[model samples]
Target: MFEVLPHLAPDPILGLSAAYREDTNPNKIDLGVGVYKDEQGNTPILSSVAKAQKMLLETETSKTYITPQGNQGFIDGMLSLLLGKSSPVLLSDRVAAVQAPGGCGALRILSELLVRCNDNAKVWVSDPTWANHIPLIGSAGLKIEKYPYFDKATASIRFDAMMETLRQVEKGDVVLLHGCCHNPTGADLTNAQWDEVLEVAKEREFLPFIDVAYLGFGEGLDEDAYGLRLLIENLPEVIVAASCSKNFGLYRERVGLAAIITEDSKTRNIAQAQIQSIARGIYSMPPSYGGALVDIILADEALNNEWVSEVNDMRERMKTLRAMLVKNLHENGSPKDFSFVNDQKGMFSFLCITPEQVREVREKHSVYFVDSSRVNIAGINQQNVETLAKALVSVL
Candidate 1:
């Protein structure tokens, strides 16, 4: 059986990281991994998180397993964060949430629940969604389909094409949407476009499964959640998988929440039990550290404010980096119009360069990123932006 197993290729993103680490070039720039990096090229822990960890260390009394739902404070805090405190869904008692290992874990658990609920349901994903989405959702015995999403040539969302395909979706199918900060492509739907998609969902009766990974990375917290909140308020049933990795800077802690909103309290209770059952069969229990950290930050008014401020700083830095990259590109004599990068929100954006160009830059200039040319904007800084621009220009 061991001999019969086939060798597998490493993940593209992780492979890129390995190659980057091995490169002897001192000026080599890494725009491959999705992790947030500060000006000093570090994924620093937020100060609020540090404070929370200190508090937890001093106060935590036991090492026993938490409930299947993980931390109740985390669940309540995250639900309130995702949906407004006064959201109708909350007021009506129609949402069920459970903790998961990470965003990946949340996605898998939610996908499993979808299969358990309706095995035949097809899940429609964006054409250029996060690479992990395919295996995470498809492995749960659901057929995966693609709808038009990003247009690499234009470096923008293919809204009309996306709407056209979604309109054809059958009733009871699941449509996976990036809540904000779309992965790989970085392009996202406008509010008007979201409304259009909502109308289509209403007409077709398809279930909406939202992936909220970069909650505060794109825009303000509430602003980033606009489309997701709209669906929850309007639709009778919705699914959400949220992460604390980006927002709380707890990547290794693997904190995430999988939530489902039903029509009423009765259905919500039933769905909650089903989700907990699915979690028990998969991971048995979720980790407590990350969730506890998030709970601490959100529960304390002073710490919550501090966390929000830190998130705002990160967001502004990325925005500044995007602008600087475009400026440097222009200065480097590349005739390409990369102005779209400034308009796109989040840490990622496709450079819209060909695969050959991507390879040439990597080989000749030691500028590392995935073959798709999706770069982590946070990787750009005052020090290496010019080098990156020069590399890109040389390839072009």
Candidate 2:
């Protein structure tokens, strides 16, 4: 029976990480994975998260099994953070939330929910989305299609092409959008662009399913959530999958929320139950410690403020790195203009290099990035910025 299992290919990013670890090159640089790293190349836990954990240790006593939906406090806090407390979605009793393992888990459960609602529900994803999205959504038995998003020629969002494709969306189809800090390509839609998408969505009658994994990593807390908030405000139905991994630095803790907004309170209650049932069938319950930490931090005004500031600092640092890289590339005598790096927000940017160039960078220069030439801006530092820039030029 075991022999019937097929051999699986190693994950591209993780395989690159392993290769980097084995290389003895002194000047090797890794820009593959999407995790945040400090100037010293460390993924440090946030101070706010530490403080919240201490408080939980001192006061919290119950470790018993939580409900299928997990902690109500965690869900409520996440909902408030994603959509303001007084937003129409919340005020009208048309929204509900449930704690999930992480954004991936939330997305998976949401896929299940969509399939449950309508077995033939079709989901439209952006081209060049996160690599894992293919398997995650497909595994849930939903049909997946692509829409034009990033343009290699311009190194920016293909808004015109995107609108053209979305305009043809069949009614009742689901359109998956990146809430902020679009993975693999940091190009985000401006408010005016978002307005246009919303109009198209309204006209097409498709539901918006937003994955807000990098809420505070783009511009700011509320600022990064602009598209999502706008959707909930103007639309009667929406689905959101939010993660605390990047913003709260709780990657391993697996804390996230899955929220749904319906047209009425009765539908909200029914949807909430369906979500809970889906989660029960999947993982039964999400982890408790991370949820407790987030609940404590979000409940306290002081801690919440500090966390927001820390998130802002991280965001600013990535922006600075983007600028520094562009400068470094220019100083290194590159023939092509690479200023688009600065225009992109969040932790990633695509170099738009061919796979052969990517291999050259890795094999000859000891520099590692994905096959798609996507680099993590957070992985760059003042110490190695010039080196990375020079390596990129060498490959060119």
Q: What is the C-alpha lDDT profile of model 2 across 1-396, one tens digit per residue? A: 899999998988788899999999999999988889999999998999989988999998887898888889888888888998777677788987789998989999989999998889889999989988888888999999999999987798888999999999999999999999898899899999999989998999999999999998888888888999998899989999988888888999999899999989999999989998998887788989899999999999999999989999999999999999999999999977989989888989998888999999999989999998899999999999998989999978
Residue 262 alpha-carbon offset, candidate 1, angstroms: 0.6
In model 1, the worst 10-residue window by lDDT is 84-93
Question: In lDDT terms, how accurate is model 1?
Answer: 0.93
Per-residue accuracy of model 1 over 80-167 as CA lDDT, tens digit each: 9999888878888888999889999999999999998899999999998899999899999999999999898888888889989999
Evaluate all candidate structures by whole-model CA lDDT and list the values in order.
Answer: 0.93, 0.91
Residue 113 lDDT in model 2? Answer: 94
Q: Quote each prediction's TM-score.
A: 0.99, 0.98
TM-score of model number 2: 0.98
